[model samples]
Target: MKELKHLNKYFKKYWFKLLIGVLITIIARIFSLIMPSYVNKSIQAVEEFMADTISLSEAKGMLLQYILVIVGAALLSALFTFLMRQTIINVSRYIEYDLKNEVFDHYQLLSLNFYKKNRIGDLMNRISEDINQVRMYAGPAIMYGIQTLTLFVCLVPLMFIKAPTLAAYTLLPLPILSVLIYQISKVIHKRSTKVQEFLSTLSTFTQESFSGISVIKAYGIEPRINAELRVLANQGKDTSMSLAKVNAWFFPLMILLIGISNIFVVYIGGRQYINGDIESIGVIAEFILYVNMLTWPVAIVGWLTSIIQTAEASQKRINEFLKAEPSIKNEVLQPTVIHGDIEFKNVTFTYEDTDITALKDISFKVKAGQTVAILGKTGSGKSTILDLVARLYDVTSGEVLIDGVPVQKLNLNSLRNSIGAVPQDAFLFSDTIENNIRFGNENASHDEIVAVAKKAVVHKNIEGFAKKYDTILGERGITLSGGQKQRVSIARALLKNPQIYLFDDCLSAVDTETEEEILNNLKKVSESKTTLIVSHRVSSAKNADKIIVLDNGKIIQEGSHQELNAVDGYYKELYLNQLSGKE
Candidate 1:
C-alpha cells in the first residue's frame, strides 16, 4: 500500500482519463443493475397473465416494454464498458511510456559504480516486466475493482429495501470472506515477490549466456551452460506454480463463499415467501437475480487481489531504484567547453563498501595540448586514473580539476563531451561501420568518418569489406578482429574532435608496426589537445613529452624516455624486458 503511493504522480497527471473511466464503469454497473429489475417485472407480468388477473393484451404490452428495457440496459452496459476500457487502458499505456522513459533517464544520470553494482538483466526486467505488472494495477485491476465497489454500493441498498431479512442472512457471511482474503493477501504478496525474483534470475541467466555464447562455444561448455539454465528454468517454473496454486485455491474459495450466499438467498427467501411475509414470488426471484449480479464481481476479487499483490511487489522493486539518488551530481558555474588542463591532487579513491583503496594519494598534472603517458602493471590504478578524469567515479579524497575547475563542479555533459576516451574493451554497437565511427558525433560527414578510419589505420580493412563502410558489425563488433575493433573505436574517438583524449591501452590488440603507425597519426591530431595514454610497452610511451610510471596505486617515477632509461628502476626494467622480447 505504501509502495503504491509512488504512482500518485501518474494518477494526478492523467486524472481526466481515470475520472472518465470510473464514471463510465459506474454507469455500466447501473445499466446492469437495471436489467434485473426488468427481469422481476417480466416474471410478474407473466404470472399475472397466467392467473387471469390481467387481460392478455395488457400483459403482452407490459412484457414487450420490459423486454425493450432489458435490451436497452444490456446495450448501454456494453457501450459504457467499451468506453471505460478505451480510456483507462489507454491511460495505463501512457503512464507506462512515461515511467519507462523516466527510468531510462535516471539510468543515464547514475554513475558507473551504480551499473557495476547492478546487473543488466535485472534493470531490463524492471523496465519491461515489472512495469507491466504495475500496468495491470493501473488499468484492469483498478477498473474492475471500481466496478465491484459500484455494484456493492448500488445493489446492497436495493437488496435491503426489497427484503431486509434476506439481505442480512446472505450478506453476513461476506465479512468472513473479507477476513479470509486479507490473510491470504500476505501469502500472495510473498509468493509474488519470489516469482518476480526468480524470473529476474532466469532473465539474467539467459542474457549472460547469450552475451558469452562465443566463450562457451570456444570452450565447448555448451552442455554445462545448458544444464545450468535448466536448473534456473526449473526454479522459475516451481515458483510460478506455487503462485498459481494460491491463485487456483483463492478464486475457487471466492466462488464457494458466493455459492453459500446464494444458497442462503434461495432457502431464506423461499421460506419468507412461504410464510406470507412477502407478497410475491417475483420479489424472491429479484433478490436471487441481484445476488447473482454480485457473484461475478465477488468471484473476480480473487483475481484482482492477485493482480494487486503482484503490482505491489513490482512497485516496491521499482521504487527502490527510483528513490536512489545518484552519488555524482552534475553541477556547473556556467556550461563551457573544457580546455583540458587536467590535474589530480592528492587523490585517493576506495570503491563502495571496500576498505582497499584503488587510488592512493595519486597526484599528477597534464598541461593543455601536451601528451602524457602512463605505464603500470595490471591493477596498478592506470585505468582508475582515466575513470577519475572522466568523473565516472569520484575521488575519496582530494579533487580532480580541469582548467582550474573541479571536475565535480563542471557540468557532467560539458565535461564528458569535451573528452574522447577509448577503453581497453573497445565496445561498439551492432551497427554499420560508418554509424559506429560516427557514434561520438552523429553529424559527422561520410568523408569525415572515412578520414578518421584512415587515421586510425582501419580504413583499408573497412574498404576490403563487401559493403565497405556500410557493412553492419555483430554485437560488440564481434565480426571485426581484435585489432580492427580497437581501430574502429579509435576512429570513433577521433571523430569527436574532443579537447582531450584518453587512450587506455587501446593499441594492445594491434601489431607493433600498425600500433606505431596509428600512434604517429594520433600524435599529429593530439598536438593541439591534451592526451593521456596508458600503456605496457615502453615503445608506446617513448615519444611522449613525459612518461609516468605507476606501482601499487602510486606514481613511482615521472620523467622523459631518456631520463627513465638512465634511471635503474621499474621503467628501465620494463624497457629492457620488452626490448629483449622483441629481439
Candidate 2:
C-alpha cells in the first residue's frame, strides 16, 4: 500500500467518475433486492384467493402488479450495472496508460551504467507483465469488490428483518468461511509473489536466446540451447501448477459453504412455519432467494484477495526503480550552448562494474575549429575519452571542460544536443534506411540525407538496394555489410552537423581507398568544426592538425603527424608497419 501511493495522483484525476460508479452500484443492488420481497407478496395473494378471503379477479390483479414491479426492478438493475462498468473500469485503463508512460520516461533519464547492470528482458517484463497484474487489481478486482460489498450490505439486513431466527441459522457457517479464507489467503500471497518472480526470469532467458540466435546457430549449439530451454520450461510449468493448485481450492469451498447456508434456510425455516411462529411458506421462499444473492460475491472474495496480493508484489518491483535517483544530474538551471572547445584536465575514470580504470590522469586540449586524432591499441581508453566529451559518464577525479565551463555545469540536454558522436560499434534500428539516417535530424530533407550519405561514401551502396532509401534493415542493420553500416552511422552523424564531432574509429571497416575518399570529404565539410577521431590506422590520423597516442591508459606521445613520424617512438613504428603493408 505504501508503494501504491504513487497512484494517488492518478486516482484524483478520475475521482468524479469513481464517485458516480459507486452511487450507481448501490442503486443497482437496491433494485435487485426488491425482487425477493415482491416474490413473497405475490405468493401470499394466491393463498388468500384459494382460502376464499378475496375474489379470484382481485387476487389476480394483486399478483400481476407484483410480477410487473419485479421485472421492472430487474431491468433497471441491469442498466445501472452496465453504467457502473463504464465509469470504473475505464478509469483503470486510463491509469494503466499513464503508469506505462511514466515508467518509460524514467527509463530514458537513467544513466548508462544502469543499463549495463540490468538485463533488457527483466526491464521488459516489469513494464509489461508486471503492469498487467497491477491492472487486474485496478479494473476487475475493484469492480467486483464494490459489487460484493453492496450485496452484503443490502441483503443481510433484509434477510434478518423478514425472520430473525431463520437469518441467524442461515449465517451460522459464514464465520468458518472467513477463517478459511484468511488461512488460504496467506499461502496464496506467498505463491503469487514467487510466480511473478519466475515470470521475470523466464522472460529474461527467452529474450536473450532470441537476441543471440545467430550466435547459437553459428556455434552449432542448437542441441545445447534446446536442452536448456526444456529445463526452464519444466521449471515454469511446475511453478504455475503450484499456484493453480491453491486457486483451484477457491470455488469448491465457496460453493460447499453456500450449500450449507441454503440447507439451514429450508430445513430450519419449515419447522418455524409449521409451529405457527411464521405466517407463510412464501417467507421461506424469500429466504432462499436472499441466500442465492450472497453466492457470487462470496465466491469472488478469494479471487479478489489473490489479485490484491499479486498487485502488491508487482508494485514493489516498480517502486524499486521509480525511487532510484539518476547518478547524473544537470547542474545548469538554464540553457547553455557549446562552441566546441574541449579539454581533459588530469582526468581519471574507473568503471564501477569491473573496477577497471579506463583513463588515468589523461590531459589533452582541442581548440574550436581544430581537428585532433587519437591513436591507440585496444583498451587504451580512446573510446572512454569520446564518452566523456559526450557526458555519458562523469569524470572520477578531474574536470572535462567544454567551452571553458565544467561539463557538469553545462545544461545536460543542451550539451548533448550540440555534439554528434559515432561510437565504435554502429547500432542501427530495425527501420527504413531513410528513417535511420533521419534519426539524427528528424527534419532533414531527402536531398540533405543524400548529401551526407555521399560525404560518407555510402551513397553508391544505397543506390544498389532495391528500395534505395526506403529499404528496411534487419535487426542491428545486419542487412548491410560491415563497411556500409559504419558509413551509414557516419552519415547519420554528418546529418546532425553539430559543433563537436566525435567519430570513434567509424571508418575502420572501409578499404583504404574508400577511407581516403571519406577523409577528404570530411576535411572539406568540417573546415570550421571541432573533430576528434579515434582510430588504429595511421592514414586516418596522418593529416590531422594534432595527434595523441595512448598506451594502456596514459598518453605516450603528442605532436603533429610530421613531427611524430620524424621521431623514433611508438607512432613511428606503427606508421612504418602500416606503410610496408600498403606497399
Candidate 3:
C-alpha cells in the first residue's frame, strides 16, 4: 500500500469525478432499497382492503401510489447507475493517461546504465501491464467496493428500523464472513505476486527470442530455442492454473457461507411468523429482498481482494525502477560549455563489480584541433577512453579535464552534444537513410547530409539503391553491407560537425583501398577539430600527428611513425607483423 502512494497525484487530479461517482452510486443504492419496501407496502394495502380494514376507493388510491413509487424508484436507480459509470470511467481513463505519461517521463530521466541492466520487455510491462492494473483499482474495483459498503451500511440501519429481529437474523453471519475474507485475501496477495513475476519472465523470454531471431537462425539452433520457450510457457501456464485453483476454492466457500446465512434467515423468520410476532407476509418478503441485495456485496469481496493485491504488486515493481540511482550523475553545479582541449591526468578506472582495472593510471593530453591516433590490440581500453571522455562512466581516481576545467564540472548534455562518436559496432535504426544521417544533426539540411555522405565515400553506394536517400534501412542497417554501414555511420558523425570526433575502430569493415580514400578525406575534414582514432591497422595510424601504442590497458610506446620504427618495442613488432602479412 505504501508503494502506491505515488498515485495520489493522479487521484488528486480526478478526485472531483471520483466523488461524483461515489455520490451517484450511493443514490442508486438508496433508490434500489426503496423498491422492496414499496412492494411490501402494496401487499399489506391489499390484505387490509380485503379484510375490510380500509374503504375500497382509498385502497385503490393506496395501491396506485405504491405502484408509482416503485416505478419512480426504479427509474432513479437506473439514472444514478448510468451517472456513476460515466464519471468513474472518465476518472479511470484520466488516471491511466497520467500514470503512463509519468512512467515515460521517468524513463527519459534515467541514465544509460539503467537501460543496460533492465530489459526492454520488463520496462514495457511497467508502462503497460502495471498501469492497467492500477486502472482496475481506479475503475470498477473502486466503484463497486464503495457502492457495496454504502449499500450495506445504509440498508442495515433501515432493516433495524423496519424490524430489528429480522435485521439481526439476516446479519448474523457477517462478522464471521468478514474474517474469512481477510484470511483468503492474504493468501491471494502472495500467490498473485508469484503469478505476476512468472508473467514478466515469460515476456522477457518472448522479447529476447524474437529480437535475436537472426542469431538463432545463424547458429542453426531453432529447435533448442523452441524447447526453452516451451519450458517458459509451461511455467507461466502452471502459475496461472495455480491462481485459478485458489480462486475456484475461494469463491465457492464464500457462496457457501452466504447460502448458510440465507437458510438461517428463512428458518428464523418463518418461526417468528408462526409465533405471531411478525405481522404480515409482506414484511417477510421484504426481508428476503434485503438478503438478496446483501449477497451481491459479499460476492464482490473476493473480486476486490484480487484487484487490490495485483495493484500492490505492480506498484512495488514500478517503484523499484523509479528508485534506482544512476552511477554517473551531474554535479551540483556544472559548467555549460567545454573547450576541445582534453587532458587525462593519471586516470584509473575499474568497473563496479570487477577488480581488474580497465585503464591503469593513464596520462595524456590532446590540444584543441590536433589529431591523435590510438593504436592498440583488443581489450586495450580504447573504447573505455571514449566512454570516459563522453562521461558515460566516471573515473575511479585522478581527473579528466576539458579546457582546464574538470569534466565533472561540465553539464552532461552540453558536453556530450559537443562531441561526435562512431563506436566499433555502429547501429542504425530501421528508418530512412536520410533520417539516420539526420540523427547526427536533426536540423541538418539535405545538402549537408549529401556532402558528408560523399566525404565518407558511401554516397555513390547509396545512390545505387532505388529510393536512394529515402531508402529505408533494415533493423541495425541489415540492408547495407558491413562496409556500407560503417561509412554511413561515419557520415552521421561528420554531419554533427562537433568540436571532438571519437572513432573507435570504425574503418575495420572497409577494405584497405576504400579505407585509404576515407582516411584521406578525414585528414582534410579533421584539420581544425580534435580527432581521436582507435585503429588496429598500422596503415591507418602511420599518418597521424602522434601515435600512442597501448597493451594490457597501459601505454607502452608513444611517438611519430618514424620515431617508433626507430625503436625496438611493441610498435616495431606490430609494423613488422603487418608487413609480413602483406607479403
Query: Which digits, one per residue and each the tens of the lDDT, describe model 3 over residues 196-290?
Result: 77767778888888878889999999999989988888888888887777777766776777777778667777888788777776887888888
Write one digit per residue (lDDT tens) for candidate 2, span 437-483: 99889999999999999999999999999999999999899899889
| The 10-residue segment with the lowest total lDDT in model 3 | 330-339
Query: Candidate 1: where are CA atoms >4 Å away?
Result: 300-306
Q: What is each predicted model's overall lDDT from 0 to 1?
A: 0.89, 0.89, 0.86
As for candidate 1, its clashing pairs are: none
Task: For candidate 1, write residues 1-583 as lDDT tens digits.
Answer: 7898888899999998899999999999999998878888888898899999999999999999999999998999999999999999989999899889988898888877788888888999998899999999989988999999999999999888888999998887676676576567768878888988887888888889889999999999999998998888888889989878876667666777878888898899889989987667787778778877887676557667878888988988898888878988887757877998999999998888556687889888999999999999998889989999988888899999999878988888898899999999999899999999999899999999999999999999999999999999998899999999999999999999999999999999999999989999999999999999999988889999999999889999999999999989999999999999989
For candidate 2, which ten residues in a row score worst on lDDT?
A: 174-183
Error of 3 at 465 (Å): 4.5
Worst 10 residues of 1 by lDDT: 174-183
Model 3: residue 88 alpha-carbon error in angstroms: 3.9
RMSD of 2: 1.8
